[model samples]
Target chain A: MRSKKEKKEIFLFLPRKKPFTDWSKLLKNDFKLKHFYKSKDLLSALLFSPPQAILYYFNRNRTVFENLLQLKHNFNLVSLAIILVLEEEDLEKLSDDRILSLIDDIILTSSTPLELKIRLSLCLHRLTRISDNNPLTGLPGNVSIELAIKKALESEVPLAIGYVDLDNFKAYNDIYGFSAGDEVIKNLARILQTTILEKTTNAFLGHIGGDDFVFIVPLSMAEEISKEVIQKFNALLPAFLNEEDLKRGYFIAKDRQGVLREIPLLSVSIALVPITKGKFKHPGEVAARAAQVKSVVKKIPGSNYFIDRRA
Target chain B: MADPSEKRKEVKKKIRKLEGLPALPPIIQKLNALIEDERSSLTQIADLIEKDQVITTKVLRLANSAFYGFPRKVSTVQQAMMLLGINVLKILIMTSSIFEIISKEDVGLWEHSVGVAACAKILAEMKEVSDPQEIATAGLLHDLGKVVQMIAFKEDYEEVKRKVEDGLSPLQAELEVFGIDHAEMGAFLMMQWNLPERLIEMVNSHHDLSRSKKYRKESALLHLADLLVHARGYGETTYVGLPPFDPKALTILKVDPSEIKEIYLKLEPRLYELKFFTEELKREMT
Candidate 1:
């Protein structure tokens, strides 16, 4: 209900010391600012009314900054931009990729008010470009998916990357319109997302373009997550299909070869490839194995997953 | 006072840009507890949301919103919750405002809607309707226009009630006062929100079976369910007696006369189950 014309809210956490540049004059008329001295206060306020961005003046309190970042991840506050303000002496901290990935941008204490304002606006603009989420499902797109896979390859903990897609999806899409097809895709995305999120917090799920999805989870939880996803997908499938198609259990549609035949109802196929440290050098190798596993899973029919056992 | 025609236009324009309706406080409190509890399953949270019409509509609206790129496909609470993860749902519950200090009449209306939803789902199951949950959703939201009237057009709503007290039927009173009935008003808003067409049709035609074109059976089922709940006295509505019953609903649903008793028998236990929750909500309101 918040109107577009309303001033964007920015939560500022500055030190009580009077040595810094005046923030009020700098952000005057451009933003509605709420000042927070304590990190806990800002966090509690976020629960009720989240601001467009958080300007945290980071000192030596590494724990507080890390806790704030963890809270953002725990609550999935991906859109709430965090701009860190650091002293020039603390410039070396920017070399940490973890901190860099977590915060939107950094502002040096010596920058003028005009430079600070421009940096804030640029940070907000970059937030949009960085979010490569699939518009339909709001899941991360190929860019993030590749990054996640690369991270998984380097992870010391054993991880499983599941390549998920639909069998008979094209036939269903052909019979039903594009809107219904999109619904099925969204439904599958939900199944994968919720099932994976329920199992572990160290997991990643993304849409690898139309009908294709990828999820990275601990190797131990991969099978259970896949089974749950398949079960949920099957249970919610009937809601999307018409009574006639549901009654017949399949619909008559043309196959890719242009021959008319009865195509089975939509079913999901997940090809899970497990990764241990130093097993696969690149994400491409994992993709190659998953592609092979997917062929086997797709041939078996019904909703199922195939875990690649070969090294 | 504005002319009835002008008032109708104003209401339509307001609903077209409608953001949300205020939900009862108790429901929001209960939802927050359910969502914040780490042990609660998604189904449990979804079940709680399904009980309240306002929250249910809001959930469906968000899931089917253009931002999600699922403009009318998502219908059930479970489906919507799946798309909107628990974190987003938590934020939604926190932002949801309550009706300006809950009143007894509002509680009564909430109970009535829950009752109708239950009864409709029962009938849908009995008739082997596809997507019975969606039908139940339509049942819960069937009276949404009345809620809109209470919030946006307080004077017009009071006027309709006064006319009803003077022996005019609630529908006739609404038509005379607002130049549009609640059924049409609710449907207009639903269409504006881009809800599923089947749901819109069912809500739009709950009173008049003739208006239902594609989803006649579903609409007829809701019509019968509304009457049955009213007859059972589970909740209160503006109607002094049973609103005009279209016997054709029974014919359209292919429900036999003997099935009426069966429906009542099936509905009694569900209403009894819901009574506990409604009573608790009332206690909290006071």
Candidate 2:
């Protein structure tokens, strides 16, 4: 069953070099590699079989560089990844900006097998993570949020993780429908992003799909950022709700079990977890802590945040 | 002769001053609004398109065209809407109105457009592109600028044709006489009409595939469709050889050089069908 998956082939175009038999043996199981010796043959082979990726061994030849750039334009380097293998001295001697721009990564030829594997894994991981952004809100999604959290933890920053979601959002969505709900989510994303930008230069805002959003800011600025987000969201709520709903302060909505209830106008609840808790290592731990705070915060009436103090 | 830059400025002024390029029919705007409105129903869009008798007939004809290949005949506006969906139907209506302008100016150009549209449809389907109808629409409207030049600037059009007869390729003649070629002109008109940006880019950069960033694959397919139609001598032409094939576009499109023969073989029968399709449309209009 695994073999039924379409194998992603890589085209390897390299100049004459010593002992590349080992290179072929290295990639044989993972990728079906097609080797091209002459520059002209590379063009023809690319025309016939468009590869998932390209591995080019760099040289100082002008014609080779031109052909590669032309090929990149043809294949759209945005969709396809091109990795360049070059020696340190040759890379310095060539010093060509055009070649550097066309390629996605440069792997020094002197790197060990384990190093090359790790670099390729990291490159693929980054590509998939970037492409996984939410389509509606265009914010980093769950995978990217996890990766960002992991990176922030590794960097040893005094990070404060805030998990934010809407209060009474389900009732609003039930009345207004999915499209209006989507607009509300997008508006919240904008508010969170703008409020964080106003407070600090370095912060990350991510959407975990639906109406849920998460942000990571420095520990000192957490309360300020959360307050600003609540204020901004509160100001925009009247515009989203009708005049009658605004005046009445609540609207008739059905609870999940089909009971009619008067739900208050939309508000937000944010759970802030400071990562200096010593017990939190991975993103899962941070998310678990946020959930515990969120349960307590939702019991309040208006938009507010609850910080986890149970460390 | 004036310098190329000076002549280009003059041509730009001429384009700006010219009138009678049909206003993009009001129906297209309504259709865009309908597409954007979350509450809009398909029946509403179908009823709106049906209000315009001219577009109604064209949309019905396209729904029945060999390109769509519905097993049963799609006879009514509602039936056509169900089969073709809203986006494809929107493009069909837009192209049908645009084709009114193309068919009025020259029958040969109309035939050529039909040929390219058929070829692009086949190419896109073979490549498994998500929207074959959009690609075919791009192929059909790729030469729209030439129609504008023929209608808007007769004297310049005569000079361009004369240069073509004197043995410069059609593109080279267009450049010598008009400063800019028909690709840029068609792209400019598309932009003015508020067509989708991808379609506009396809028209603007079909001649130069490298310049296209977002719609390069679509543009490359249109470029090759134009060349294939010209190769078969089906469209209006002065009998120059196939336009220069960008090796880069071929690579990007992933079309094997050997597959050209197979594509042509598949396109021939479709061209014959579209020929009848064009004539029937013309007869209905008259």
Candidate 3:
């Protein structure tokens, strides 16, 4: 793009758009970068072409570039300009000149590796997150919870495992249809992500398919958070039901038999044991013991109950 | 004397076999080679591409996408050539070819590749650096190692996935899981392909700019470019999150945090535009 190399000219012009597809067009055409605009023609001469020269281009708007700059990799906008060299002869003499120095300044300010690095991390992060993420309830699925527990056990930590089953959930589901039932389950899940995680707690929360949920708490805070969970459930139960349902002597819902049945209000049945304890050794054992308690709670009239491993 | 050494040797062998993930996918290696050669004729380029029938069709499909946004469907390689020009065409070909290779990845490494590539191109130009095409390539390929891990060690990858979600940098999770990283794999792949040393250096040193002593500036640039995209929060995998800034990288570029934000907003629309093409490229390539 530079002719005769006489005036040692230099021309520079900023492209108005992103991708600078316009600028890309010029470079691909063998035109000197110096020819962007008429006045900018000296760009070729300004830099020591085939000539050695360093260049720089920093993003004009700071926040966007800075946000991108936060990535874990080394992303310097300036060095990317250096990568654009023509890679030819005339290397040394052109090396250190002030007028030519401006070219490096220009290149780096516009685009660089840092920007590219930032862009890739965003895309990769997206690819890594699970799409099946339960939005209504942040609790992980059966598999994720299993892995978390397995890992905790592998690390030999002091852990508390609990299986939480809602009392009268089937009757409720049959009465309200699945949506209202979902709202109840969602309310319960919220309590877990929020109320149950205490400072001393290392929690693993999961939705085991339907009405059953699982929790893994640190040995120290497991009882406190567990008690808090039951209290919270009792406190919040009234809000989910209508005035008529609340005032009614019993919850009016269809039984699994499809006949209308009056049932006690909602409650939770929990089975908890410390991971470090010998009695409830494997996760399956804890789950089975918890299930036994949950099943027993169904036989009684109260809302929810706990399986005291000590008992 | 009965070989305490043999047992050690056996252990060492077992570990080595399990270590160093598969190199970058084969299809990527072939295409990158084809594009890097300036001496290669269009026929050579087209022939090598056509040798893989699936790749050729995908290239044609992507060539027609808005990334190129030609008026008519481009059925032939030459037509694609005429539409996208040599550089853009090469980039499209490389990108499409890459998608084809990464198509099987569940980790969304390929999707992330396209997003980062688009973001990289935008940031490069915004700063007026010449990273548009080349930088985009690096952005897309930076995590090829993860792809290798996804295929080779699914179980470990899943475990590492949770660690990352719970907050571990990709590099850290990698070390935790496989005791290796994409950088080493990338560096090895780049070398195997005999790519320009500069690209290999940039890829290997992207995570740590200080490691790139000879190519310090370029290494630092790639590092910064990678971080910028992470901060944008564009794609899914939120784990292997942003690395801290190197003060030297700032002094060299004469840039500040304020400048990064300006470019991020400016880059958003352009990224969206590229997505139109990238998706088309993926669909066709796959």
Candidate 4:
């Protein structure tokens, strides 16, 4: 529904009965601003039509600010820039990661109109640069995926980087059409995402384009998360396949060579590459090891995962 | 009075295009408390959500909406919560309107649905059915048609309730008043929402076992769970006594007379737990 030509929408939540700086005169030319005096109105509007950014003037309503931050995190509203307008004394609150991580940028209440304008533009500009989410699943794309892996490699904590892909996906697309294929991919993405989230909060999930995905979790949680993903994928697969194909457990589709063959129904293969302090030098090395593990996992039966046990 | 058949068609059309349904205020309140708490696990939140059918269905509808591109794939609350995440859930609970100014009767109906959900899960586990949580979901949603009737067809719903009070059976009153029963009406909405076919089948056939073909066992389990919950007097329905039970449900689900007692024993504690939670919510509401 969003078009490039449309004026960027920004929601402004300001304190009631306060003599704060009016932003309408400054922002009217470049943006569409809707003002909200009540927190409920602001939240409901956010749900109905999420603005590109929320300009919240901080005051005594710290709870409202926290709720906004939580909403931004939970909904994964990466594109919604939350710019806080607070007094200089409020700068101490920024030290809290919970508050710091959620807000896109901050502006002082005493700042000139020009400073506010520049900061808002910079926040919006940064969102475009960092938004590497896959269009299909809205998950972090290849760019973030690589950065997450690189961070894991450099971090001292042991972590597991999982490379997930679908088995027989090409055949599924050929038989059921492209839309159906996309549904399967999204389903897998959900399974991976939710499973990872359910297991631990300190995890990363990204869509590496098409049917492939990448998830990074603590090393101890890798196998458990993989098992859960496989279990959930197998459980939810029936909804995507036709009843006849589900009953037969396979469908006759043309192979890459153009010969008819009994292709198995969709299943997931997760290649887990564990990273210790110095197990891998870079993200590429991790990918190469995952490729080797993936070959082994794909060769086995339906919805399987294999962890690279080698040093 | 309008022709029941004509009314049925109109109601079906409305439900097919139904956009939103209100949830019980108490459930929404409980959800807020749970979600705001820093330590509430996803499973814990999903457990509370599964107790209320209206919220459960709404959650599933959002997850399976065409916008998500996974229509009919995300059936259970746990799965839907995973995909929707905790943040969206906070907004959903905050934004969800209260059920037409909550009444004691609506709270009772909520209790009945939760009781049936608990009983169905126990039965599913006893029978070793795959995805007991899903069967529990079916039980929770079995009376979604009643909710639709109450919200969309208020006059006719009161008429049906009055007829039941006048000594007619609930299903008979429903058929005479609306040309269709709650089971089928709820099923139709579920189908329109693109919920899983198995779930739709179970909801459609909860009152009538013969209507179920593929998921007869699940339907039968839900049917029995409904009866057991009613008999326990854990919650109130339009029926003064137990609704008609299909004897064949026992055979289909392979439940024995002794096993019924066992299910009751298992259900007692869960209902007790849920009762405490609901009572707390009611107190908070007051």
TM-score of every candidate = 0.83, 0.38, 0.33, 0.73
For residue A47, give model 3's deviation from the true position in Å: 50
What do the candidate models score in CA lDDT, each in turn?
A: 0.83, 0.68, 0.51, 0.83
Misplaced by over 4 Å in model 4 are A1-12, A16-51, A60-64, A87-92, A95-101, A105-130, A198-202, B1-48, B85-105, B114-136, B148-234, B241-286
- Residue clash pairs of candidate 1: none
Q: Which stretches of candidate 1 lie above 4 Å from their native place?
A: A1-103, A106-117, A120-147, A177-180
Instruction: Provide the lDDT at A293 for model 3.
Output: 64
- Kindly report the docking quality category of candidate 3: incorrect
Candidate 4 clash pair list = none
Off by over 4 Å in 2: A1-311, B14-105, B238-240, B279-286
Q: What is the TM-score of chain A alone in each candidate?
A: 0.70, 0.60, 0.57, 0.84
Model 3 regions lying over 4 Å from their true place: A1-132, A155-157, A277-281, B1-286
Every candidate's DockQ is 0.15, 0.02, 0.01, 0.30
lDDT of 1 by residue, B103-194 (tens): 58767888899999999999999999978888899989999899988888887888998999999999989988888899999999888777
- lDDT string for model 2 (A1-311, tens) is 33724556778876556434566567666667788876545654453235666777776455665655654442233435677778888777556766665677878888765566566656655665666667666676788899988877765667788999999889999988886787677667766765675457578888898889989999889998898778767755654666577778897999988999999888899999887634567778788778889999999998999887765
Number of the top-ranking candidate, with TM-score as the measure: 1
TM-score of chain B, per candidate? 0.97, 0.68, 0.59, 0.95
Give the better candidate number (1 or 2) by lDDT. Answer: 1
Which 10 successive residues of model 4 chain B have the least lDDT summed? B98-107
Please, what are the lDDT tens digits per residue for candidate 4 over residues B1-286? 7798998888898887676678877778778999989899878999888878888998887777775567777778987876676767776677677775655765778789888988988998999886788888888999999999888888898899899889899999999989899999999998887788888999999889989998888889999999999999987789889899989999988878888788888988999899987787667556
